[model samples]
Target: MDELTRAVVQLEENQVIEIVRRELKKGTPVEDIVERCRQGMEAVGEKFSQGEYYLPDLIMAGEIFNSILEVLRPIMAEAKTRKLGKIVLATVKNDIHDIGKNVFKGFAEANGFVVHDLGVDVDPELIVSTIKEEKPEIVGLSCLLTSAFDSIKDTIERIKQAGVRNQVKIIIGGAPVSEELKNWSGADAFTRSAAEGVKICKELLES
Candidate 1:
């Protein structure tokens, strides 16, 4: 792991900012810097899965990642000419946790996807309405609490009832989301990793 990746995994916010700024000054490609950060985040996720880290740690890591993005946003904006796709993203109703959702948003945006974020504890009707208005190719639902599984299922059902389900692919994600939940909720895909979620969104579009 490079210093940037190690600093991020160690949750060293100041060092991360310093290294990123130095790298940018040294002419590192924006994509390469972002990839290093992603690698660090992936490692953090592995630690979380191993029980070496907890929810607070994940939240802290997200905050650090966001800081890094703020540093890169201007360069990224200047470099990006086209969007890969549009995604309507939100934390499902009855669940207010948004760290995972925000992290996913960062990865999605970094990968050239324009995201319409609905924020936390969003209603299914609003999500469906946004899908209709934005005409996005994908909808991404996020919830950390397992109790919000029903909200995910209900949201998809509402989309189907609204007759727009076929127009957009649905993806569910968060700590508790699984392939089984994806099946149960009528979603086309599910993932716990932000990077993996972005990959799935791409694959969904290709298919």
Candidate 2:
């Protein structure tokens, strides 16, 4: 990666706001740096899943991500595209885990997709309601608990019942979930990680 991208990677790896700020001041487009940071987080996640890293490291990265985002927000506004399609994302009701979702949100946003994060323990109906109002092209449903997975099923059914299923593509994830659940949920696809999820989302959008 280039120096700007490396700076972004450092921001995600360490969440040092000042480091990214200095890089941005050194002539990197804020967008390039932000996207690079998101990629770095994905790399960290890949390593973590492979047992090369730990949760504490991920937590530290997440902290750095938030810190840099604060400085990059205004710069992002100036770099906005015309429209890249919207994606509405949420954790199902009863699931509070969000590290994965947070990482994926950054990836999606960096890729020119407008992401609406609905936070944790989100009810299906709220997701459905948001879909109706936002009319997003994609709905990203995340769940980290096996018991709380009913929320994912119910949300899809509700969207179908609301007659927007065909209009929106669904992507599901989090631990305790599998391709089987994706098939069962009638979703377009399932990915083991946020990195893969973003890839699937891009494919779905392009296809």
Candidate 3:
């Protein structure tokens, strides 16, 4: 990889916000840098899918991706009249692992989502209450374990039970859930990887 690609890849690995800003000052096009990051994430996702990389590496890549986004998000915000949409994100109950959660949050934020993170081991009731209070357009339920998939289910049911199911889109993911599981849970979508998941959410938000 060249300097720009290296910077973006390293940026995703290191979460170097300053490095991205410096590259922007070096006359690198923001679009180019963003695209480079997309490539880096795709590569990381591929590695994960191939079992060549573990969860920590994936999460680290996410940290890097979001760090640069912190610098660019304001620029995008300033240029655009409105963002795609706000979202509430969290890892569900009994799942203290936040590696995937952080990665997904990074992807969402980098994709221009204003994310309200509920943090690890999040409760279904709390997730519902946040929607009632924040009124975000999307609810992203993140679980890193098959054991924690119930939290995703419980969270979705709470949305229906609270009668807010019609108001917000629910997207679920983590280590074990599938698109079919997402459907089974009555969620709008399930993404296998963070970057592609953001694409789906962005497309849905735009539509």
Candidate 4:
């Protein structure tokens, strides 16, 4: 692996920031650097899935990745990027976890989607109201607790009841999400990783 990639995979915080600064000094495109950072994060996610890395590793990687994005955001804003539409993100009612949601938010924004993050423990009524007001193309529900599945189901049901279910695609993610739960909660898609969540959101919008 290259320096940047190695730094990220190893969770070398200082080295990661320094590498990004060096790349910027060399006149490298911010997009290239952002993509490299994402590649590193993807590797982290893969290691996490394989049990090679634990929650602390994921959390550290996320913090480093967020730092990288903070460095690149201004440049990215000035660059020309294809708009990937809007996404509404939240932790379902009664779930206080935001790690996965925050990670997904970074990926989504990096890929050019405008993300509206409705912070942790968002009520179904608020989600419904936000969907009505924002009319985002994708609704991303996150939950770290298995017990929050009911909240996810209720959120989706409320969206359907609001009569805008057909207008948007719902995506559910976090530790307990799966194809079975996706079907059970009536979500259009499910992913275990934030990276995959971003990809699925893109595909959902395109299709």
Candidate 5:
């Protein structure tokens, strides 16, 4: 593991920031730095799955990743490339958990996707309205609680009822989300990892 990755895994905010600045000064590619940080986040997720870390730790990892993005966003904007696609993201109703959602947002932005984050505990109506207005090519729903599965299904159903379901592909993500849940919720795909979710979104756009 690299210093930057280790610093992030340790949740050492200051050290991670210092390493990022130092790396930028050394002319390191911003994407490389971001990848290392992402690897760290992946490690944190693995730890959480093993019960070595908890919700607070996961939240801390997201905050640290956001801080890294803050440091890189200006440079990223200066070197802006054509956007890959548009995505409307939300944490479903009755579920306020946003760590996964925020992480996915960060990765999506870094990979050239315009993500309209609808924030946590989002109403299905709001999501449907956003889809109508944003006309995003993809919709991403996030939920950490198993109980929120209904909210995911409801949101998708609402989107279908609103007649926009055919216009956009839907992807759901969270600790408990799976192929079964994706099928049950009527989503096109599902992921537990933010990185994988971004890849899936890219595939959705291409296909």
Candidate 6:
């Protein structure tokens, strides 16, 4: 394995940061560094899925990936790289959970999506208004509580009522999300993981 990839896969936070900084100083391409980090994150996710790593290990891997992005974003901005798309992301009303939302936001932004995060406990009306204002291509809703399914359904219903439903793709996710909830909420897709959400958004844009 490459030095950077090995550091990331091993969850060597200090080594990862140091190597990333060194690579940046050496003028390595930002996209290349981001890809290494993504590979590392994918490795961590696989380990977690295989029960070889614990939840805390996965969280640590995510944190390391986020730190890597913090170092690369400024470089990309300096290069004037255009975003792939705009995404409206929020944790639905009455559900203040944000860990999943923040993770998803980081993944989306690192992959070149400009995410306008509305923070936790967002109202459906505000989401509708934001859609009208931002005209984003995707809206991502997150909910941790089972009860927030109603909020997701109501949010989509509100968007439909506003006549903007057909103009945008809506994706809902979090602990309680499923195909059933996707259908019930009228969202275009549902994902259990932030990584899958990113993949889905890219596919939606391409389609």
lDDT of 5 by residue, 69-147 (tens): 8998887777658899999999999999887787788778878888899999999999999999989999999999999
- Model 2 poorest ten-residue lDDT run: 7-16
- Ranked by lDDT from best down, the candidates are 5, 1, 4, 6, 2, 3
TM values, all candidates: 0.88, 0.79, 0.75, 0.81, 0.92, 0.74
lDDT, candidate 4, equals 0.87
Poorest 10 consecutive residues of model 4 by lDDT?
29-38
Candidate 1, 118: how far from true, in Å?
1.7
* Top candidate when judged by lDDT against the true structure: 5
lDDT of 4 by residue, 1-207 (tens): 778988999999999999999999899876567667777887887899999999989888878887887887776677688878999999999998776687778777877888889999999999999999999999999998999999999999999999999999999999789999999999999998777788899899888
Give the winner by TM-score: 5
- In candidate 6, position 94 carries an lDDT of 91
**C-alpha lDDT of residue 35 in model 1:** 75
Model 1 vs. true fold: TM = 0.88
Decide which is better by TM-score, 2 or 6.
Answer: 2
Off by over 4 Å in 1: 46-55
Candidate 2: list runs displaced more than 4 Å: 1-15, 29-60
Candidate 6 C-alpha lDDT tens digits along 48-163? 87999998887788678778778776776676656889999999999987756766776777678888899989999999999999999999999989988899999999999999
Off by over 4 Å in 3: 2-19, 26-35, 38-66
Ranking by TM-score: 5, 1, 4, 2, 3, 6
TM-score of 5: 0.92
**lDDT at 69 for candidate 1?**
81
Q: What tens digits encode model 1's per-residue C-alpha lDDT throughout 124-204?
A: 999989998999999999998989999999999999999999999999999888889999999999998888899999999
lDDT at 49 for candidate 3?
Answer: 87
